[model samples]
Target: MFSFIIRRVLLVIPTFLAIAFLTFVAIRLVPGDPVEARTGERGISPERLAHFRHELGLDQPVWKQFLDYLWQIAHGDFGTSISTQTPILTEFTTLFPATLELAICAMLFATILGIPAGVIAATRRGTFVDYTLMGAALTGFSMPIFWWGLLLILFFSVDLGWTPVSGRIDLLYYFEPVTGFMLIDSWLSGQEGAFSSAVSHLILPTIVLGTIPLATIARMTRSAMLEILGEDYVRTARAKGLSPFRVVGIHALRNALIPVVTVIGLQVGALMAGAVLTEYIFSWPGIGSWLIESIQRRDYPVLQGGILLVSGIVIVINILVDLLYGVLNPRIRHAR
Candidate 1:
């Protein structure tokens, strides 16, 4: 298990390098010049442009710039945002909690409901319940996030007036963000209706963000459960006259969770990707919105650093998930 964990941790180095390099190259390949974009119309003089480029180290050769970027990151410096003049790391930390909160809520929403739904579907295979649940999962998987978000907003927010249109909380509640997670902070603030308001604001965004993950998790769970249920132990447990719940839940579900856990971990990336669209639609104040604003202004440092940071987070999560495989199924560690 220790060796397996070490291997996974070591693998992150190369993975991070690859992601960082690709993000660096890809952002540079985009047409807009950050300096020019920041300056906007009524362009600066040629000398001034040259100075700006040099100041940003853009005048350096691509190889040198890449090396410098690597060196800076190695030293824990993500560099100051070209647009904000603030350290990228500082801005990321400030905004990350919101994204973290949303992602957590979304994943919780998916896992809480998806697992049971999948179990039911698999247990009742070939029945109407199975078909209906599977169909809903397929529809959810197929839905475009932006379109789904709008549809929900129109119905729930616009017409029925059940939820707020955007933002993390109602403007009426103003208090210092103790934890940056509105739900927790609201409760901590002891402000009347603050916690409820935060929950209400989170509802639509969580649903929109969680839909695909829920679908994926549910389908994966069903597949895993189906296979596990067919195992000899499952039949043996049933033949032994164990309760149906014990046969399925304890024996089958535990063994089945290995693959389902992997799917859930992979969903972190999906949740983050989906958060961009959901945040934009709901005007949620998270890193997704921050990244969008940076992109509009062609903020290269923020774009590159932000993407690298996000990728690092995803890679770390995947590593943790890989380690969890050992705990779920001891055979995985033994095999390694």
Candidate 2:
């Protein structure tokens, strides 16, 4: 297991380099010039434009620029943002925790609801329960997150006033950010209503962000369970007069978790991708929204760094998932 983890960790370096390189190239390929974009309509003089380009090192050859970027990154520098002029890495660090919080909550929401729905559907195959659950999964899978967020806002926030329309917490509750995760920090602060305010603000976005993952997990779970249920071991367990709960929960569910785990891992990546839309709709300050702003400003450093950071996170999660497979089924670890 240690060797497996080391190997996976080693692989992440090359993968990250590839992603970083691609992001660098892609951002440069985009037509807008960051200097020009920053200066906008009544632009600067030719000499000023040239000075700006040189100052940003854009005047250098592409190879030198990339090498410099690599060198900077290797030294733990992500450069200054073209727009905000903040250190890209610092900006990323500040925003990433919020995105992480949202993704974690979204995953929790999905896993809590999706797995059981799937198990029930699989066990009750061909029945009304199966059809109803599966149908709901399909709807959730197909629903647009932005639209869903808006609808949730309309119903829960605008109409019922059950939840806040947007933001991480109510502005009324002033607490210093310690951990960066509002939910935890709120509780840690011991301020009145802080925790509830954070949760209230999180509800709509979490549901919107979790919907597709929940649907995907449910479908995958149902499929995996269906297959596992027919396996000889399951039959043997049933024949041995194991209780329904033991047969399904212990025997069937554990075995079926491999595929479900895969879906859940992939859903982490999906949540990051989906958070852009969900965050925008809810006005949540996270990396996703930050990335969008960077693009608008043609902030190449932030764009490249953000993409690299996000991809790195996704890759790490996937590697962790691979490790989990070994734990889930020892056969896989032994095979490796």
Model 1 lDDT per residue over 148-252, tens place: 999999999999999999999999999998889999999999989999999999999999999999999999999999999999999999999999999989999
Supply the TM-score for candidate 1.
0.97
> What is candidate 1's local distance difference test score?
0.92
> What's each prediction's TM-score?
0.97, 0.97
Worst 10 residues of 1 by lDDT: 1-10
Indicate the worst ten consecutive residues by lDDT in candidate 2. Answer: 262-271
> What is the C-alpha local distance difference test score of each model?
0.92, 0.91
Candidate 1, residue 107: Cα displacement in angstroms equals 0.7
Q: Give one digit per residue, the lDDT tens place, for model 2 in 1-336.
A: 788789889888888888888888888888878998988899799999999999989999988999999999999888889888899889988999999999999999999999999999999999999999999999999998888888989999999999999899988889788999999999999999999999999988999999999999999999999999999999999999999999999999999999899888888878888998888899999998999888888999999989888988898899888889889988997887
